[model samples]
Structures are given as C-alpha cells and as structure tokens.
Target: MLVERLERFFQRREEARRRDYFYVTEVAKCPRQIFYAVKGFPRPPLDGQTARRMALGDDVHRRIVNALYSLGLAVAAEVPIPENGLFHGRADAIISLGGENFVVEIKSVHPYQFDQAVAGPRRDHYLQLQLYLHYFDLQRGILLMENKANQELKEFLVERDEKVIQETLDRFRNLHRLIFGEGRLPPIPDKSDWEYDQCRYCPFREFCLRDATEPPQDTLEERDTVPSEGAPEETPPEKEGSGKERPAPRDPPPEDGGMEEILLFDL
Candidate 1:
C-alpha cells in the first residue's frame, strides 16, 4: 500500500509539470481557457474516455515512427521546437521524402472529421503545423490522419504561411501579457455554430462562467456597508418559534446543452 501511494504521488507530480508549460497545439484553443491554464487555475480531472483516447493517440504515434524507421526512411521522432521556455511543443516525426525534409503530424479522427479534413486542412490543424514549420525552418509539413472507425488513412501537405504564423504569434504574445503582465483574464471566445466548438466542451467552462456570475469584491463590500453614524440602527424582528436558521436556497438547474465531441490527437 505504501509503495502504491508513492507511485501515485509521483504520477501526479509529473502530470502537473507537464501542464505547467503551454504547448503549440493549445494555441488554437479558446484563449480564455489557455489563459486560465497559464494562470495556474485548478482544472477538472479528465474523464476516462478522454484519458483513454489520449493514451491511444500516443501509442499510435510511436507505432508510426517505428514503421518509418524500419522502412529505411530517415526519420527523427519527437523533435523539440523553439528551444524556448515561453512556448513548448514536439513535432511527431521529421521524415526525409525525396531528399526534402517535412515535419510530420499524426492525428486520429472520427470519419466525419476525416472526411472534412480530406477536402482540406482544418483551421486549427493548419495553424499548428505552420508554427512547427516556421520554428523548424521547413517550407512544408504533412498532416497524416487516420479514421478511427475503419482505420483508413489520409494525408495533406501544408505549406508554411507567414501570415498565419504572425497572427498566431501575436495572439500568444497578447495571452502572455494578460496572464503574467497585467494579471487579467482573457475574454471568452465568441459563440459559434461550428461542429467542434471549443468553448462548448471546454474543461474550464465552469470556472470561467462562475467567475462571470459572481459579484466583484468592491460591489459586495458596498452592499454590505453599515449606515452612516447619524442614521438610526434598525432592530431585527423577533421570531415566535425556534430561532434556528433556515437552509440556503439551492441553485437552479443548469441549462441542457450538448456539443459535437472531437477527438484530440497529441503527437
């Protein structure tokens, strides 16, 4: 029992360390969610389904890299980016194809998402790969995705876009200012009707909403202030029965809502 407890403790410590740094993949998420993370707000624990998917993604990444190496392709796995602590990320694998280097990113998605991706790269995925290419000084990258339903594979080639990279950089720089410089929370993302809406299923949804609903400290203090010195003090009304305090009122039920669940692949 003691050994088991020690192992669990170390596991938690390692997980905390992993979350301390911002990753390039997270840049495309809700800025407020990322802001809460960088500000060290406590996040809800990952549900079993989400945790399992993450593990499966990691296993697939390893298998793909090993297969490339066995086929005599020049491959470098888990290539670090930027070498700067301000931002952190690892490209899945850098492979040499026809004597040209390409940053490789692997993803597992549902059939619907795979269909959409086949037509063209998704916005978030496109931006993420662009950052990788920019940092690695490569002109192109490949997004390799597999359909979780039938194991079908598809790949898309993405060229580096300087405009997208600059926009992404500007956003992160602003996020850093909000978090560490001004000590203010970032604004919530505007609502969208997209299939995979980031805010609808964000883990920090409750935290951000709760902060929004609560009254500010100054307002609360003003409401609780006593009357001026010249004003008369009001007397409390006496109860005829027992003076035991009544229970506080319960909160109204939350509105019923749903969002299209998206599978996140970490490489």
Candidate 2:
C-alpha cells in the first residue's frame, strides 16, 4: 500500500511538471507564495492528512459528475482551457442545463466553510470560476460545494464579471514582472504577525521567512561582508552608561493541524 501510494504521488508530481504554467487556483493565492513556487523553491513534503483530504475531494467530484450523467444531462468532464504560458486550468465538468451550457466547479469544504460559502462565493473560489467563464466564453457557471463532514450539498449560480477577470489577468501579469522580469520576490501579503495562523500552514513559510530575515545581496561588497563559518565573531563595544540585559528567545507555539488540501483540478 505504501509503495502504491508513493507511486501515485510521484505520478502526480510528474504530471504537474509536464504542465509548467500557473493554474488559476494558484494565482488566486498569495503572490509571494506563487513567486516561491515559480522560482522552484523547495516546499515541505505533503502530509498524509492532506493527501487523504484531496483524494476525498476528487471522489466527491467524480460522484457529482456521474450523478449529472445519470440524470440524462450532457456532461463534459475535465475540459481543458486554452494553453497560455502564464496560466492554465481544467474545468471539472461542463453540463448542459435548460438548453444552455454552463461550467461546473466542485469544491468539498468543511461544514463551517460550506455555511459561509452558502451565503456567497469565497474569493478564491469565485475567481477560479470567473477565469473558467472567461476562457470558455461562457456567461454563467455553477459553483457546487459539498460539506465534507455531513455530505450536504449547496449550489450557487455565478455570472461572469468581465471587469474582475481583467483585473485578475492584470494581477498575474504584474506578478510575472516582479518574479520573472525583475528577479525579485513579492512581499508577503500579511507580515505584521509572524505567528499568523495562515503563515503556519503556508507551504512556502520556511522559504518566505528565511528570505525575510536575510539582507539583500545586490552587490559584491555586501555579499563579501557576510561571514563564513569559523570566522571570528565581532563584538560590539560596551556602552559607557548603565547596561541593560537582553531577553532570551522563546520558542514558537505549536501549530494547529489545519492542512490545506491541494485540490484535484489545481494539481
């Protein structure tokens, strides 16, 4: 079983490499995270919990597609978008409804998330569907979300927003300029607190934080000044006034087990 799991994992990774472009879902995430990804920075290995959640989400998607087919609806599964060097994605299914075709994007979320989404589409989820709508030239699409815990279903009808789509495309282009053109990393969207809950779960946390701590190396003089290992440490001169002791460093708090599952279509 372990061998089979490893094989499947590598197969997915290989398939991901073959498509060397960003997904709409990824571009919806923090640009700094995307920059690290595009630069080929190493990320932590996928945990089993995350893997299981992703598998479950895939199963839910398949089941939804099959159910649509059973109802005698025309369903196109895994519809690929036009290949753009900067972005690409596949709609889960396109179903013909009421004599009109509509894109279908499925998401499996926790009960609380489902409740929130029922009120309105989440930012990332809404952006992903809009990209699909723009790419397929469709005006309307459906967002189907299932509550993972209770298997409850909720659907929302989303119309294409040309302005939003254009904004998203512009953002992606700007991000490309920062990362690929200038060879500079984007600042973290939220950095006021290092112990921010989301930062703990971010895949690029180590790389992002490490870069934040180090000074930029824009010149040879600055680069050479960085001490090599075993070099004598320089001590600051003692002050002539009263001295104050520095506080000892404290360890970070334990992270919560909140893993963000990499969805199937994004993968």
lDDT of 2: 0.60
TM-score against native, each model: 0.70, 0.70
Can you write out model 2's per-residue Cα lDDT over 33-102, one digit (the tens) per residue?
A: 6665545444445555555566787899899899878876636888888877677678989988767788
Best by lDDT: 2
Model 1 pairs in collision: none
The lDDT of model 1 is: 0.59
Global Cα RMSD, each model:
15.5, 12.6
Q: Count clashing residue pairs in model 2.
A: 0
Backbone clash pairs for candidate 2 read: none
Residue 260 of model 2, lDDT score = 27
* TM-score (C-alpha) between model 2 and the true structure: 0.70
